[model samples]
Target: MTDYETIVYVERESVARLMVTALRAHGFSPREILDGGLPGIGTGLTGKGLAIAVPASEARDAQPLAEALLKDMVGK
Candidate 1:
């Protein structure tokens, strides 16, 4: 099996959620990681930001799109 690696890290949970949805719509298996673990209630309040991760094998392809989405969201 392949390992998973974070492709993008965003400070806002909203952006992280959007990234997960966008990545999923593109057929990539994306997951949200909070403080190095799966997210739960009160997690986002820690102030440590969140991450969007995908399989290491797909990281190269997903990184650009993830970064682009993040940049776009931050612009608005």
Candidate 2:
């Protein structure tokens, strides 16, 4: 809870929103997520890409979910 780490970068706007929502449903914190696709932003998750953050300790669990989401989105 001290700090969150940016664990993955998702390029699609829709996918990024889904990732943040799904991660919360899966028990991650809203505060821990950074949706790069958020409107009206200037930097970071803005134009760079949809970047997501999670507790460093939770990265192990986050990895698979992130991968699966990205895989599913990319495959479509």
Candidate 3:
């Protein structure tokens, strides 16, 4: 099994997809995990969020670019 490192947590699917696209555009491979799938009938409802992760080795190389992308995204 391969271990993945969590990079960013996004509350909206659209934001998550945008982050993924940005990562890809910057030449970094990222993965998205949709948490809060149905389990105990509404138990995980509040946990519905998306997580973006990349390989541990690539994290350091991707951080600056991701940060810049996020800055542009959030208008910071």
lDDT (CA) per prediction:
0.77, 0.68, 0.69
In order of appearance, the predictions have TM-scores of 0.74, 0.66, 0.66
Point out the worst 10-residue segment of candidate 3 by lDDT.
40-49
Candidate 2 residue-wise lDDT, 1-76, digit = tens: 2566776777665667778788888987534434344465534445666567777777778878877877887773
Residue 15's lDDT in candidate 2: 68
Badly placed stretches (over 4 Å) of model 3 are 33-49
| Model 1 ranges with Cα > 4 A deviation | 32-48
For candidate 1, write residues 17-64 as lDDT tens digits. Answer: 888999989989986444444556323555655767899988999999
Candidate No. with top lDDT: 1
Candidate 2 local Cα displacement, residue 1, angstroms = 5.7
Candidate 1 weakest lDDT stretch, 10 residues: 34-43
How large an RMSD does model 1 have?
4.2
Candidate 1 vs. true structure, TM-score: 0.74
